[model samples]
Target: MEEKLTDRMCPNCNDYLFYMEYNTEIPYEGNITIKTYLCKSCYYKDVSIKRHDMEKPKILKLKIRNKNDLKTIIYRSPDASIKIPEIDAEISPGIASRGYITTVEGLITGIKEKLSLMDSHDAIYIEERINNILKKNSEEITLIIDDSSGKSKINSGRAEVIEK
Candidate 1:
């Protein structure tokens, strides 16, 4: 099921083309609500997911040791935090943070894309580390997803779940 909302204005374009979609049947997130936002005027988009069951919070960890591990899929809530200590990378939720589902490789690639937008020396160095991870050159990178709301998860048997 889905609900369409269109009574909002785009923050970027200040146009009345902002829309939201609420979905109830997202895979791997049983009894969860997924909110998606889009702005037709500015081409802005975002997604957030929350569990209706209100389960306990959890910290999920996955070790990426081979190419198959990079194919692991995960759903990240807007309030979740992602960390890869191997690359000294951490992504915490902010005002503009959004949620979505993607593979481990896709997540790392997304980080690389964001880092590429920066002009600082640190960003370039981090981008190179991210490249090594993406190229499967890094040895045993650990992917951590901490979600206080327990709305994020790794959809693989290899994932380690720590209830908090």
Candidate 2:
């Protein structure tokens, strides 16, 4: 079932935001609830996934060897952390973090975009490294998603999951 509630004030802009929740059943994953909040005023948005029957936490790793690997799908939970050791960058889970579903290429592009908004000195080097990976000009890069909530996943056969 789906439930929707709107008019919630956005923390950033004090504007009305829309909130929606729904439950879905996956073949082997049982019941899961998804909640989404969106604010058109300040462009604030967040998505969260919760499993009715929670499972053990796990770490998912996918090595991007070539361009094909960049097409791999990734579903990242808000409670998960993303690390690209090759580029020396890590997106830690915190209040600022958000859940998202995107491809490996999209994830890398997002890193570049976020870094572009920052004023750090090392942002240039990190952006260059990200570009090399995106252009398929560098060695293999590993994308790691550490999810304590056990809700994040890389939808690819090449993805390795290590249970914690």
Candidate 3:
């Protein structure tokens, strides 16, 4: 892993901000670069990731059933689209989107955090459904990821991969 820390101006506060960059290799995957910005004045922060190697576009799918499945790791590229149809939840790549690696449970927790921030009836309903899924009250849920960069993956034996 390579790390660098620098100082820059924060876009939101016009104050001195801390910037960090990391370059590292993931086993079985290519090199990845991550950049982070943090503003001490406004408490603003941002992070982004990019892969050094190019790959063919592909789609991956995984089913979450038992507690063990929640431990499955996921690598989401900056150009990937993540979808959980059962919960009507989807995350599409955008200009501000960042890439990250996390477990299935971590992904669900992230979605829950976003849902809790919304103040709508639909959001409440979805949150409840997601809660049930997390608690194993519901049936199996499928996670589908479409990655244009082809750097994303569901690291599990049950994961299905399709090239596009």
Model number with the top lDDT: 3
Model number with the top TM-score: 3
Which of candidates 2 and 3 reaches a greater TM-score? Answer: 3
Tell me the lDDT of model 1 at 73.
89
Residues 1-164, candidate 1, lDDT per residue (tens digit)?
44355777777887664445464665545676656677766787766665566557899999988888888988998779999998777899887676689999999998888889989899999898777767855777999999887889898898999999
Which residue pairs collide, candidate 1?
A: none
Residue 80, candidate 1: alpha-carbon lDDT: 92
Residue 136 C-alpha lDDT in model 2: 59
Model 1 residue 23 CA deviation (Å) reads 7.8
| Native-to-model Cα distance after best TM-score fit, residue 64 in candidate 3, in Å | 1.1
Residue 90 Cα positional deviation in candidate 2, in Å, after optimal superposition: 1.0
Q: In candidate 2, residue 159 scores what lDDT?
A: 93
Q: Is candidate 1 or candidate 3 better by TM-score?
A: 3
Poorest stretch of ten by lDDT in candidate 2: 1-10
lDDT of each: 0.80, 0.84, 0.85
TM-score of 3: 0.72
> What would the TM-scores of all predictions be?
0.70, 0.70, 0.72
Give candidate 3 misplaced runs (Cα > 4 Å).
1-29, 32-50
